[model samples]
Target: MRAFLPLIALATPLALGACGDPAPTYIDQAWIRLSPNKDTPSAGYFVAHGGDAATRLRGVLTDYALKVEMHESMSEGSGKGAMMTMKPLDSVDIPAKSTVAFAPGGKHLMLWGVNDTAISRGKMTLTFLLANGDRLLVDAIIQKPGADAPAPKADEHKDH
Candidate 1:
């Protein structure tokens, strides 16, 4: 019985160590660039960190905006002669243990017909719909056109 007691203690720690909770997916540093012309669509950006499992960003929704879509801006040419083209994206994959950044001149959210009151408030709730049956709610900071929003920390941009 004494030998069995020692074995039980040895196994107890291993069992407890295996019971860790899975990391949850989340979003941070979310923001929307307000357009000077209300008629023009505004751009939104954020960083999404994947959980223990891989997932895709299927869509975005906000009650303050009439419509939202994911998009990517690509530069076709090289150097000073580069031309930018915007392409709509169906979804964005987030690999496990990685971070995806939606930044200026990169993958971003297109917000059309934003409510005037929401704009004046300087913030709004943005919901990110994930392919794996998870919805993340984040508050998006509103920035005036040409406002110098802070850049993402270097470490947070590991994967696009």
Candidate 2:
């Protein structure tokens, strides 16, 4: 009986590890930068993670803005003004256990014609449309570009 006890203990931990939960297929940490001026558009970013299955991000919808689009920054060619363009995207795939980061000068969500309420200060509910018709509702955290203060850093200590 004593010899069999050791094998049972080892097997218990192995079973637990094999029974771990599956990965998440969702978007989180969604944030948006407030425009420096009312005329300019804002950039939204977030992370997308799909578990063992693959998924794709089709587009986005938000009532606060006139238009929402998935955009990739372009190198301004020899134009009169800043070289940029807004090209329509079909979809973005989210592979299993991988993350997609949307940020400035990258693949990001462009929020145009934001209303007054969402301009200076407010929250906006943006739903990310998936290829599978799964809707992931995300909250866009609003803050003016270089507004009142800088973002607090992890190394920044309160005591200091």
| Candidate 1 Cα deviation (angstroms), residue 102 | 0.2
The sequence of per-residue lDDT tens digits that candidate 2 reaches over residues 24-138 is 5777666778777768887787778676678899999998899888988777667577777666577888887777877666788888887777655556888988887789887
Flag regions of model 2 displaced more than 4 Å: 1-22, 74-86, 147-160
Cα error, candidate 1, residue 10 (Å)? 11
lDDT scores of the candidates, listed in order:
0.91, 0.76
User: Ten residues in a row with the worst lDDT in model 2?
Assistant: 151-160
lDDT digits (tens) for residues 3-32 of candidate 1: 799899999999999988888788988999
Residue 13 local lDDT, model 1: 95
TM per prediction: 0.84, 0.68
TM for candidate 1 is 0.84
Model 2: number of clashes? 1
Can you tell me which runs of candidate 1 are displaced by over 4 Å? 2-18, 79-81, 150-160
Every model: Cα RMSD to truth: 3.8, 6.0
